[model samples]
Target: MLLTLDLNDQRPLHEQVAGAIRRAIAEGSYAPGDRLPPARDLADALGINANTVLRALRELRDEGVLEFRRGRGVSVASLVEGRLAIVLRLRELLEEAGRYGYSREDLIEMLKELP
Candidate 1:
């Protein structure tokens, strides 16, 4: 429920919302099978339009990070642990790589060479 958005972020509002939700899930704040706040509530909390939040939620669903249920609303995907772990680690890796002068493009190139 504690989603933060940077006023200076250049990403679309929906992407920023999705990123905040992803971080929340990665940090164990919202566990697998947990229901997220409704889009209107999230919109109010994040000061974004409800449609934007809904769009983000839909994207998360498509990414397998979240599940949409007719009566249950939106919940974290039951099998998201493995995926979330990778996502969280990837973020950390990218941040550390930044400090070491490795651009994301550089990391992508390295990964492309993996066996």
Candidate 2:
């Protein structure tokens, strides 16, 4: 899979990395048991610090979207339940944004400005 980080983006690199991985999982690009690349390797591939990659991995682990074992490396977790919950949360957020008079374009622009 191709992972990218935009140096020009206002959001931190770690958040972007985590978002990429999360989107991959949500879109079925990664399965529950799929293994993720090592932190150092992914860092090299993305031209970022290894610590940044690790931080992203840790965020996913904390969110129950990834599992990290001592020797097994990181892998996508069995997040079927979490997946549904996240979908529901996103829907709710979209509805909330609409209620606040935020158009879809406005939401997209706001997300683009996140940091």
Candidate 3:
């Protein structure tokens, strides 16, 4: 799997790494049940610390984008497509909300008001 980091991005390194992995998943570079490179390998490829990559991997696993297998390392989740679609759409919605000067809390409130 290919992962790219944006030096210009102001987010924390772990978040950037997580976002890169997320993009790769959403772009179909990694399919359901595809095993990812080991954390050491991913760190070498991205020129980041191994711990940083592990942190990102843990976050992705928690988000259900990836799963941990005892002998298989990490693999993309089988049901990721639907989750990715919603995540991508929510990202776009947040970007649109930002353009309109809407706070994240405002979006949360809107969600709360939804039936």
Candidate 4:
């Protein structure tokens, strides 16, 4: 999977990494049971510290979005219930956008324009 990170963002590095992975999963770029790149490799690719990637992966694991194995690394968790986790995550995103001054109408307009 192609992962990108913005180091200059106000959000923590680990959060950025985790968010990218989550988006990939939500958009079906990475399906359930797909193994993510090793922490060291991803860190190198994103120009961030390996520990940051590890922490992000751990957060995903805690959220049940990923499963960590002893030697196999992290794999995407199967979808819970019948829908993609994006349903709940989109709510959180909308709430956060509202906090950042995006009106509901503005969000709706953006969504309407999405392919």
RMSD values, in order shown: 2.4, 7.6, 1.7, 6.5
lDDT of each: 0.91, 0.83, 0.90, 0.82
Candidate 1 lDDT over residue span 2-46, tens digit each: 998998987799988988999999888999999998999999988
Give the poorly placed runs of model 4, Cα more than 4 Å off: 80-91, 94-115
- Residue range 34-94, candidate 2, lDDT tens digits: 9998999989999999999999999878878899988999998876557745754775688
- Model 2 regions lying over 4 Å from their true place: 80-115
| Best-performing candidate as measured by lDDT | 1
lDDT of 2 at 78: 75
lDDT of 3 by residue, 1-115 (tens): 7778889988789988988888888888999999999999999998989999999999988988899999889999999999977986787798799889998899999999999
Using TM-score, rank the candidates from best to worst: 3, 1, 4, 2
- Return the candidate ranking by lDDT, descending: 1, 3, 2, 4
lDDT of 4 by residue, 37-64 (tens): 8989999998888999999989888878
CA deviation > 4 Å runs, candidate 3: none
Q: After superposition, how far is residue 53 of candidate 1 from its true place, in Å?
A: 0.4
In model 2, what are the clashing residue pairs, if there are any? none
Candidate 4 global CA lDDT score: 0.82
Task: Please say which candidate is ahead in lDDT: 1 or 4.
Answer: 1
